[model samples]
Target: MIERFYLKEFLTFKEADLEFHPGLVVFTGPSGSGKSILMRSILASVGLDSVEAQICESSVTWMIDEERYGLQNESLNTFRHVKKEKTRYFINNQSTSKSSMESISSTYLRHLSLKDYSDFDPSAILKIIDERISARSPQYAGILENHRVKFAEFKILSDQLRSIEEKEKHLSELKEFALYEIGKIDAIKPTVGEDEELNLIKKQLSKKEKIETVIAQAQGIFSFESHVSSALGMLEVDSAFFDDAMNELHSIIESSLERMEELEEVSVESVLDRIEQISELKRRYGSVEEALEYRKQKALELESYETMEHSKSDLIKQISAIKAILETSAKELSLKRHAILGETLEKLNGYLGMLYLREATLNLEPCELNASGEDKAVLGLAGTKLDKLSSGEFNRLRLALLALGVESMNGGGGVLMLDEIDANLSGEESMSVAKVLRHLSSRYQIFVISHQPQLTSMGQQHFLIYKDDESRVRELDDAERIDEIARIISGDSVSEEARGFARDLFERARGL
Candidate 1:
């Protein structure tokens, strides 16, 4: 509930500070007395309406989710909209965005001044209908739960089936791509380290001739081996060490010749070409190991592509089975919903009867399966759609629809701000509307504007707005309320009979 409201430097009213209580709060005055302006300013303070007030603030009892919104929740949370060159929103003096403020406040406030269609949503309607059905048949809850479980299963299977179909649509291209990638890698059957070996051979061949010439010239030294050994003996050096050294030199020369002979079998062109192929592979795939790994992966993909039809056929069978079960459950639900639709309409019509409006109608039609069910409930008036009704008639119908949910609510529902709900209504019609709102006030903090004496007199708290140099508002006491209601009944020149009538009506409404 809004505990206090303050508005300053607005369209007509300069400054107004008001405290409020829970129940029906009715604002009434002559035309152009800033009644609507005051209401809009209140809504703007909560970020629900756009107004040009310098400072519009509301102190409410709504406990904001402090952790979620990252703001402190005072016992009385203050929502303020300050309009300077631009608009700014704040909660508890902490700066917040307009959207954030609106999000937090909308949970506790519902402005039904427009043709809101939320009441007629199929999910919301179906929920209420199912609740009623469950109350009558306890077994219906399990049945509904079972249907919901199957519906969830059905959705998963249907999505898999759709995915399979999409894949099948491009199956040929996918198969071709897998085959192309595999074949491209297969054409280069290069081995790891083979490139390094070929490059080594190429390096040997690059210097093979120079090394051969050098070795050919160095072989002449073998002829002097014996001469050097004899000289070493004559010089009294050890002949054994000299003979071992010559033998080792001869073995090195022979080994070199043998390795040179082995090079005869190696074709430089084949070695270079192999080197080029391996280089290309390395450039394309980073390494021979990575290329081989890619081939293995594509082989598996190709295998799956070859057997895709089997997978698709199996998925189709599963979907068909699940869908058949869902359809059965849907039909059962449809039957039960049809049974409860009349009860729903009768209750709505009962409320409408009191509001002096035409009866409302509800119809259920078959639709595709969803989480909610397969029912599309349509709510309309007897001869017209809800949108085609006049503002007064539409608003009253909205009230009746809201009344249906009031019974299910456990505690304080929320605040409801409405425009002139009793406008263009007969005295009896006005009183009927007032009575319904008075009942609703028990559940919600209702704020409304009125011009008729019947509705004004029914307010739990009445405030009279009048032009005294500037538009001003004051809460009316018993005598003051009587005079205001009288003015509404008989205009500026209030008759004694109007005063008496207003007093009696106010007392009777309160059961005094």
Candidate 2:
């Protein structure tokens, strides 16, 4: 339960702090005296408004005792700060996010008001009834979980099949494109390493003449050495002294003559063969590496097209199987849900007093199955639907649903906050609303914002919101509450009769 709320610079409430107790806590005030402003401030602090206005500076603290509900070692305080654009929420002094705070608080604070009649929502109604019925059957959650997974899988497969079916007409065109590409590369008959071999052969042919010229120059030097031999013979006249030198000179000339003859016999056939090989490579492939890459691409395309039909058939089969499974699961779920609808209607009718002429029913009509079940709620009163009910009747019906929910709750109930729930209600209807709210307070921490005396008197903790002379809104207590309630009864004039009426109402509420 929310233990205390503080507001600062929020609308007319410059600064105010109020404490709340268990049971019914009602906020009553004159018109335009910041009653609604206070309520909005509280909602804003909890991150429920879209005003984009900063908190100015405020703190709200909720003291939770989970042990009362059989939870272990879980006593903590939750708080919210409205200082900057982003509201900071904290639990047990640890920084947290608004969503986290709201989630945790919701379990402890179940706010039901006349504005939100649970019976009107089929999902919430189903959940409550299912919980009661499933309490004896622990396998219900597992069953629901399994069905949910199956439904999701079926949806995914069906969507994929639809996509493939839509594109099937173009599959033939795609196959034709792939075949054309593969055939174009296959006809080339390219080979790897052909480019490098061609490059080597081309270099040899281009430098062929230069290599031959160098060989010829070496031959001429050896062939013209006859003049040197003649000069060596003349130098042999110094017979005995020149004998060793002349012999060495003759041996060198003979060896040079033999090497010249061998050089002159060099062949051009190897160069001619290399030139022909390079020319052939250029004519066939343009470039050997490019042709090899083309061959690889063609092979991949052929493989892809060959397997496409098989893949399409497999996807179709999978989609059909998933659809069958989903249909079976959904049928089982619908059967179970329909079986329990009758008991749910009985409980709703029992709580909402038959005098209201209301008949709530659930219709499991055929609908396109989705994540939620294919069922709808239709609430009628005397053959008139709930949407057509008068505002007063709607409020009463909502109150009845709340009373029923509280009674059905397993442990102490959630905190219930109501804003102007008593509006447009008749005196007798107001009395009935008060009685129900009073009974609900025993199970839930009920916070009500009402203008009716019946509700105001029902409050276990009465707080009056009013403006001081400075026009700043503040919460009043003790004598201030009595004076404010008296003012509510007397309007601008607080006569003895009005004071007496306010006092009598207070006394009777205390006794109750």
Candidate 3:
């Protein structure tokens, strides 16, 4: 709801600041009194319309879509349009583009008489139709809810089944690839510690000849071992120490000679080949152990692949069962809606007839099963699309729809702006329109311009726009409202009888 609006430097209006409330807010004055200008400025303040006003701003009780637009929610957000070098829009003091501001405001504000077809959209129609169905059939909501749940489960399982089928088209190739990877690793037949031992043998083989020559030359030291002991015995000095040293030298020579004989049996070519194979495994899988682990994993996957058909069969059976039940429930829900659509259409046409318009047809065509079931509701206004209708006819149709929704709307729906909704309407027709608007005002905050007394009397908040030196507006007292309505009824010179009639209508509207 617009809490207040301020306008400055617009044509024929120097400055105006007006406080507003919910319910049917009406503006009334003689022709060319800038009533439309005031309305456009109000719309510009919210980015619903363009205006050249230097400053147009409105404070509203609308919560900004903080997740999308990144603006904080306030008790009241101020929407402003300023024209300095160029037009700029601001919401809650945050700079925003005109399109962005309009998108945010459109969620809470609707210009009923304009070319916006949001109310006639298929999703909106289906929602209202379902609401009407819910009113008549107590079990319809349960059926619809069941259909939605099953349909969701059905879609999910269907997607999974489809993916499995697609993979099955290449299942043979996949299995072969897994087998080939396992075979490639098994061919190496590598062991973890085998490579390290082979590397030691390769190092020894690389120095085999040189190490053999050194060991043969060192054998001479062992040959002189007995001579050294003899010399120590003759000198009678540490003959036992000499014996122990000779024994240690003899053990070292024997061990070195034995290791050299072992290396002579090691094939260097075979050691090199084994080392290359282990290096390849290391390069591919980081280690021989990792390669073995990967082979184990692939074998497990192949085993699972061999058993997938059983799982696929199980899923198919489950999906078939759910699909059958979901289809039945969706069909039943559609039947319930079709059964109640007449009552919904009758209420809509009744409202339309009162507004002096023709009947509207609601087409419930079949579509794919969805969360909304298997129905798509489209409202046709005498074969003319809503966006193609004239302003007056279009607005009347909108009123009928809004009236139909009053029963289902839980609370305040949004703000509605209409321009001269009662224009050129007969007294009876205008009164009917006013009554419908009054009914909707419980759910909507309506702003309307009126040249007729019937709607003028219906305003919960009435303001008189009159130009003296400049276009000015002020809230009217009861007596002043009567005068204004009487002026609307009797033209430039208000008659006594007109004043009496206006007072009665004003009082009657209050009673309604």
Q: Which predicted model would earn the best TM-score?
A: 1
Each prediction's RMSD over C-alphas, in Å, is 7.4, 11.7, 7.9
**Candidate 3 regions with alpha-carbon error over 4 angstroms:** 135-143, 159-315, 378-389
Error of 1 at 417 (Å): 1.3
lDDT by residue for model 3 over 284-376, one digit each (tens)?
A: 999889999999999998987788898799989999999789778878877877887898889889999988887889989998878877789
Model 1 TM-score (2 dp): 0.73
lDDT of 1 by residue, 221-321 (tens): 88888798889888999899777887898899899889889998889998888888888888888998988888899999889878878888887888788
Write down the worst ten-residue block by lDDT for model 2.
67-76
lDDT of 2 by residue, 40-112 (tens): 6666555453333344222333444444422222243535555575556544455656665555566656444
Q: Which candidate is the best by lDDT?
A: 3
Candidate 2 lDDT for residue 331:
72
Q: lDDT per model, in order?
A: 0.87, 0.64, 0.88
Error of 3 at 363 (Å): 5.2
Better of 1 and 2 by TM-score: 1
| Regions of candidate 2 where Cα sits further than 4 Å from its true position | 50-125, 177-336, 354-357, 370-374, 381-417, 438-446, 471-487, 490-512
RMSD of 2: 11.7
Q: Lowest summed-lDDT stretch of 10 residues in model 1? A: 401-410
Per-residue error for 304 in candidate 1, Å, reads 5.7
